[model samples]
Target chain A: MIEIILGKYNYWIYIALMMIGFYAMIAKENLVKKILGMNIFQTGVILLYVSISKVSGGTVPIIWDKGGPYDNPLPHVLMLTAIVVSVSTTAVALALIVRIYKSYGTIEDDQIVVINSHDGDKEIPSEKASTII
Target chain B: MIELLDILLLLFLVICAVAAISMRDLLSSTIVLGSYSLFMAVVWTRLNAVDVAFTEASVGAGITTMLMLAALSRTKRFEFLYRKKGQQEDPNKETNPLLKNWKRKRFSVTKVSGLIVVLLTGAILIYGTMDMPDFGDPNSPSYTHVATMYIERGQPEVNVPNLVTAVLASYRGYDTLGETIVIFTAGIGVILMLRKRKKT
Candidate 1:
């Protein structure tokens, strides 16, 4: 147990981060916070992958000249794509948040759902008001 | 694989993540998340994954935070609590049941459900980690697999000097091409979603 805990402390730290992001995504009412939580969660996973590729006596993946125990370049290549995709995803999520705000005047998930629930009972005025606002 | 410096870096990372999540001000949290990415990038560099570190610094710290701030500029920065009595998404929808039931708030279903899900996930992840070869284990599956060949015969198979660049462009050319298309689609999606239309 002690060896598992101490020898693999890196995994535990990353797990803590992943849990933090997960909790925020679930518990936060603000839409922006949720987006940021997603970012945090992605970064934790990225770090986990990068850590797995490390070699104790290795140098960087660049092999321009000399040779040694270079770290696995596969995860690094894969995570480059992951990191870029993460950014693009964030841009899209933010765009959606903006649109949601324009339609509902607030981005809180609960409040938006409530507005939709009452829209049926009072339909026309809500439509007109949403456009006017 | 573990060092005192690495331990300190991870410590700072956890602290930043905790601060980013716990803060009520969304803007502050966003910037704190930026710093978390920065530190994580540094750690990746220390792990000899410079290419990953490069993208993390540029995309994670730079573009992600900029996008967050842009969104924040157009929205409220503080969290909305259920206890706030009169504030509503639509004033026209005055007869909302949630408003009437505010004082009688039975429980937050999302929070409880999320906690249950996250706990299960974290437990599974921890268990998964137990089976993974220890950090810097030379004979690990990842190293023993094609990575050995990549290190041994990389120079011969691909003319590119940088192994990461060679593998990314040559070995996984098709995957990277698909990713480029995905990014282009995302760019178009953003423009369509956020671009203001000329008023009719």
Candidate 2:
């Protein structure tokens, strides 16, 4: 039991980190908070991948005169790409959020739904509707 | 890995993650998120992934925070709680006395259900981790594959000391090109969504 705990503590912590992000994404109503949760979740995955590449006594994957085992470079290269992709996703998601705010005048998911449900009935007055859309 | 430093960093990360999500002010939450990304970069460095650390520092902490702040500037900063219809109409007026009492005690269905779902998923993920190889074990399946070949001959063939660069640019050049295209497409999409049209 001790060996298992010691060996896998990092995995457990990463999982916990991921769950925090997951909770935020699901429970938070604000669109920006959801986006922040998505960012945290992506970072958690990246942390897990990078953690997997560590060789116990290895140094960085740069060739030097000192002969020693080097950490796996594959995961590092992969995560580098993943990080860039995450940034790109954030940019696009934020743009969508901005547009949603412009159209709905609110970024809350529930409020947006309320606005949509009232769309067909034209129950909302013209003055408020003009500001909304 | 430096075990003590690793534990400290992970603890800090968890705190940052919780604080970032729980803060009512969006701007402050974004700043905390930036610090979380910075700490993440430090953790990556401790794990011997320098290239990834650099990318996280620049792209994660720098660019992502800037984008979020820009979005916040365009929108409201504070997250508002769901207001009752009666409350929205008049600040002091109560439509129904019983309804006001019921609203005060009402719980959010979304919050409760979301917590249940998140906990279930987390439990499953923790169960899956039992079969995973121990951290930093050189004999793990990941190192037994092409990683060995890449590390041994990568420097000699590509004449680059950094094996990450050699693999990313030479061994996987097409993959990098595809990623570049993805970023380009994202940039174009953002521009299209945000640009204002001239009045005709």
Q: What is the lDDT of residue B53 in candidate 2?
A: 93
DockQ of each: 0.60, 0.56
lDDT of 2 by residue, A6-104 (tens): 787778778888989988888888899999999998898898899889999999999999869999999999998899899999899999999998887
The top-ranked prediction according to lDDT is: 2
Candidate 2 lDDT over B26-145, as tens digits, reads 999999999999999999999999999999999999999999999999987887555566555323243333233323213577788989998998899888988988999999999879
Docking quality class, candidate 1 = medium
C-alpha lDDT values of all predictions: 0.82, 0.87
Give one digit per residue, the lDDT tens place, for model 1 in A57-106.
Answer: 88887785667788898888888888888888889999999999887777
- lDDT, residue B78, model 2: 81
Highest DockQ scorer: 1
True contacts kept of 2: 0.86
Clash pairs for candidate 2: none
